[model samples]
Target chain A: MTTAIGQYQYDQVDRDFLAARIEEFSEQVARRLDGALTEDEFKPLRLMNGLYLQLHAYMLRVAVPYGTLNAAQVRAFADVARRYDRGYGHFTTRQNIQFNWIRLEDTPDILRLLADVDMHALQTSGNCIRNVTSDEFAGAAADELVDPRVHAEILRQWSTLHPEFTFLPRKFKIAISGSPNDRVAARFHDIGVIARPGDDGRVVFQIFVGGGLGRTPIVGQELYDSVPEERLLATLEAIIRVYNAHGRRDNIYKARIKILVQALGVAAYRNEVEAELAQMDIARYRLSPEMVASIEARFAAPDLQAPEGAAAVLAEQRAQNMVFDRWVRSNTHAHRSEGHIIAVVSLKPPGEIPGDVTADQLDRLAGLSERFAYGELRTTHLQNVVFGHVRQDQLYDLWRGLVDVGLGAPNVGLIGDIVACPGLDYCALANARSIPIAQKLGARFADMTLQEQIGALQINISGCINACGHHHAGHIGLLGVDKRGEEFFQMTLGGRADDQATVGKILGPALPEDDTVDAIARIVDRYLQERSGQESFLETLKRVGEAPFKEAAYDTV
Target chain B: MKRAVRVGAGEGLVITANRLLDGAIVWLSADHTWQTAIQRAEVLVSDAVSERLEGVQSRAQADGVVGIYEIAVRPEVGGPVPLTMRERIRAFGPTVHPQFAYEQQEGAGA
Candidate 1:
């Protein structure tokens, strides 16, 4: 038991596969550049390799495989950003990172470099199954019953260019969580799986299907309470097979699995899946106990030993500085290891862009991860990084190091911790810019005292109705709209992404940029004024209903 | 500027596309060449839009460019400027990162 990855580091077979894929893509790029292929023919191929033609330039998304990264992988990303992009890369809501300013001619070489580090741009985009997302604190969190990374990594292997599911009705996304707290927003995926402790002391799968967010946001319903542990993959295949055969293809908007599930009721959908499962060769698809154990054994077990007087050291450090106390209180999450804590690094600094890490910062953080953690870093759906196994005694020193790199913001889970999408600034589909508004809100809540006063709040922002920023799951959701030639923003209140997932409703009319920021301030102020002792913002909103909030928002408009 | 033939759109159009090799924003000049600066672009009169757009489409087929389209623009003292905010940002660059904007280039004054 040590920080070293066990026997299953991406072996030579995977390396050869990535090299072959990159070689094939390089030839395709050459053909396109030589004018042998038109944009129409080349678009899908490029998309399959995670390249997209955005508003200004070509944007390339690199897969993170459930947001896990080693020190070398982090350093590799930094190299790509410094050499290929504009000194920085954007972390997406789906736990991947994107380089915004990439040249078509330079993509093949960039991919070749990524392949050298055992990474490639495969299945990050296109209509095929996207990157499988899971709880960021999968193996380290205290509440976890099973390490979802074991299954998520298995799915990453299973879905990569699967012959049957390569071309579905539309794009598919799957999210899983090992805890009931549901950090990965499982209820809002095409297929949501929860790993829970079964009666016989084994982890059972709880399936939720037909949930998605876009033009229509639907909360996924439970398909099964307890699927046998070994039959998990087979059951997922059955659900996707049914969706592939029957989902609507005429309209792109209606092509998602949620629409199909809604059109045919959940019971009917379940029956169809059951019929498909009955017809398939279930034995071939079954995940054997040995197979599961083998996957688990490949992942390195944390060798975290309890350090004596760690709690006393943490208490003494907190007593030394009030800022350190606030940061420890907010950023420290419970860990399964007794002497360790999960340290959340907020990418959202005072008034800066959320989820953006510079080349220098990435290089420094890679070194820091090796020292504080077991050279492992996890990226959250909320656009933050996690050092999953920091010993309690070394936390203050780690915090000092992070501060030197300008990433030591103590705003984890506060209103300052906002999730925003790349809006009109970079995306072609966006109607307005999401970052500037997020910047305004971030600036408004920059003060640690004010943020702590406001308490644990999530404010999510999206450029359009595509909901890439997970605005539908925010406590205070802001959706950008285009009113004629102008950019307007609409607000929603009381949505959450926890176990009780709920989509927020519209609060009032859409406001212009500055007015929208003011309206949020007014709403937050009203909550602070009328809240009971230690009541959360959502709790206060629920107690008083939406009338007071609605009144406060439109009071000056 | 004359009223556009296309309904629910602005008058006076300027052709824009991304260069195929690098995906950089290019504006069509009066000589039918793609230029990186909007100041070098030739805004088309409403009467000449149909013919110029046809020629540009043919050029796009042969030239190394993708996603060719027309942007709504009105004549300014220095050059033809994009009307919509989206077009303006695309013609320039992302407003958040001003250092990379086309307006930062020499002679393309912001």
Candidate 2:
């Protein structure tokens, strides 16, 4: 039970799989370089391998499965950043890390390095069931019913190189949460699965289908209230099969399963899935209990037996250092194990790109994770890192170390911690630059005291309707639009991505680029002034409605 | 004199595309070659914009250069300034990473 889960150890078969693909891609790349394969011919081949020609350069998106990474894997990422890319890598909204400045020739080597580390870029992009994401704290969270990663891993294995679903209507996303609290934004994914313990103590799945955010953002409708553990695969198959058969293929905009589910009312869609399931042999997809148990056994719980008086020591440190106290308050979460906490290392330092980590910083984080976090780290959907099993006694030391490495911002869920997509600056599909706006907002909310006072606000920014930043799910969402080719921003209020996931309502007319930060400040001010007692910004918005925020936002001087 | 080479005309456009090999920001040059330095851009008048851009696109298609388009630019003291903020950033590189910002290639000129 205590075996180290140093990434799903890629056996010889996995290695061979990657090796063959790598060889094939290398040849393709060479041919393309030597004027053999045309751009049209080479594009699909490159995209299948997780390569994209972005605004400036060829970007390589790597699959960091369920956002879990060991020290060595991280170091390899750092190496890739330094060697192949522009000294940095961006941890994307999907929990995958993308190198923005990858050269086409260097991609094979990068994939080789990733393969060596039991990591590969397969299904990170293109029309496939993409890198399966789950709760960053799946195994470690106190309220977890079951580790979602166990099933996530199962799905990863089942979906990897699957022949049938490779060329779907659009790229598919699946998310699993072990806990009721949806930390991975499960409601916004194409397939959302919740693992809950049954009365008999066996794990069951509650499945949601067609949940996605893009040109058309919609919360996934629940397809199955509770699917037996054995029926999970069959159930998922039925859902995907229905989607594949009926999903719009001619129109790229209307291709997602969310649109399909919406077009056919939930009941009708469910009926289709049910019909599909009825025709299928469910037993063939059913996993034996022993198979499930073996996967579960591999996810060994970290040794959390800290030295006695660890809590006392943490309290003493908190008492001695106000800064440390602020950090613990903002950045740490309760762990299932005693004397341990899930420590979030904020990537959103003031005026920095939300998820950009320098190679040097990544190397340092890798070392720190090895030293303090059981050689394991998890990248959150919020674009931050979580040390799942950091001892309370060593919290202060870890904080100090993180601060030295420029990863400590002490504003995990606060306004300063913004979630932004790489907009026009990097993305080809963007209308405005998200990073600068995030930088401006971060700077405006640089006051730690003010950020702490504001408390637990999710601010998400997207360059376009394709809400890669999950702006539709933000407490305060900023969508960048091109108003006659000039950058303008639309603000939305009251949206959230929890169990009660709601898409934000647009507040009034879109504001000019220059007016964005000021409007945000004004909105925050309204929330602060109008809120009753300890009601959060979202709570206040829900209670008093968006009128106050709208008024404050529109009241131009 | 030589018609004063009107700098701020509506079609004072530059053919810009990402390089085929590395996806670097490149512009069509007077010599019918691609240059990484936007300073070396060959601006075309209104009549030539479409034909020149089309020709450039065709030439670059096999080279793997993508998203070729004519970007409007106004002549500044030193070089042509891209009209939109999008093109400006693309011409100069990301504002966030100043170290990796587009630098003048050794032999390129305005």
Candidate 3:
């Protein structure tokens, strides 16, 4: 029998908490329908429960904390999709699941369904501390320093319905990473914490603050070199309290902690946080070593001993089938345990929405996860699913299963695997469409050989300056703008999100939507020509600079 | 006409709002009910635009219809076409997901 690892099990108290919330929201919905509550008053209530009024209908976002979910939860999601949404759900960059076509009237039922499955939409939206996200490969990755989900769960429990943070100047985002690779884009969050082993073999957190990507993109500053495990919550409280006091309240644009941190400078911000920490009772929030150990115990690694001769079998299968070979090379990642692999199931296909998955697809994935992945799955920041515990011997069968389901696309980290926001088509703030652009690009680079030759590249597209698609972190970024009632795109290059993160630089004047594909083609062609042997697109651009690319893009246009 | 002039769209106004109960795109009709059909929309002419817009606003507030606004539309042979892309898409649905568009439906409504 498979043991559930790192999955948060709700106790009777937890279930009661969510059930009470559902009843409260149900009553609130009734009051709003009867005109007892105005839309102004109801908006926050709905938002706190993760409901949003989109261009077409009310959108409901469900939290999958730290990107962890089991087979049953995934099946439940499929059921919700079939019953409530229009057959599909969109996975977001923050590792949350969003349904774009939900009706406001059906949200109460949806919450109840979610509560039944030990899940809730709590803190998925609203100004309070949103869902704590981490690397999709949290416990399973070989390179992880610690299981980040333990700390993430601790933060989740402490921060839920946090009274002091409910009405912050703007929304607050926190991300954690246990690995040095920084796969979760932790540096881009408002408060990014990285766990590392201290000198005494005890886990410590390296805190980062003020990093965000919106209209104003800024790389985070290092706040503390190392904070002890017990002091994490108190340190976080100090940082947030400082932000809550000094963050701009007058203008919506200047309200985020990133802006305040930028205004105060890293040194001054630290001084304020230090001042707050000095006055506060640190013992109140300090997690005891035993408490932390108990939390960590819940996330014990699966006893998955690799099967003997599995690698040889996998190697033989790879040599026989070229498609399987390419897929294995592209989609499967190195596993923490020997004779196993972490397989990324691509949600992106040619001429389809970037992060959308149908109900049938989710159901199949759930079944597959249970069969091959120890009944668990992970949602990545790139809007893809991960079967984090797949045995090497069963990979061929898993590949066949995925291929049958039309999900065997070998495009992870390739040009075809694009990150795009719901632009003008669905979002009210968008001036231009993002999906069509991404689709066109994906189609343009459909050749697997060409994609492999080009190497790792990220093309992020945003409909507006809100930067939901994380254009700032893309190697080749496209931001859609409206110029005189016409859709135009601005290109940026050389941005990356690793241990050393950097924001992209704008290329030049915006090009018409019709000319964007051609512009991108020219930029890529320039990189292919200028690159030294085995140099990546980012490396080539960094070496030759934007002048050559700009010359090719604008001169051709 | 005065309010239309303020927003820089001079004439041919159509009252639109999201239905409070379902959040569906709806137009204020001549009968004062929020109907899903764009063809059944009450298009206010030059002089009557301001007066009719105010009436629709009050009615919209009372009826729980949200984000009520007057959009510029040009009278056509088949139906009135919204001037801006936003209003046009609102009248229809997502341009990408054409199946979800109101115009593509059998009844052809929001």
Which candidate has the highest DockQ of all? 1
Tell me which residue pairs clash in candidate 1.
none
Give model 2's TM-score versus the native structure.
0.96
TM-score of chain A of 2: 0.98
lDDT: worst 10-residue window of model 2 chain A: A1-10
lDDT of 2 by residue, A325-360 (tens): 999999988899878888999999999999999999
Residue A284's lDDT in candidate 1: 92
lDDT of 2 at B66: 66
* Global lDDT of each candidate: 0.87, 0.87, 0.86
lDDT by residue (tens digit), candidate 1, A327-441: 9988889999887888999999989999999999999999999898878888888999999889999999999999999988999999999999999999999988999899989
lDDT of 3 at B86: 69
Per-candidate DockQ values are: 0.68, 0.54, 0.61
How many Å off is the CA of A243 in candidate 2?
Answer: 0.4
Model number 3 iRMSD: 1.5
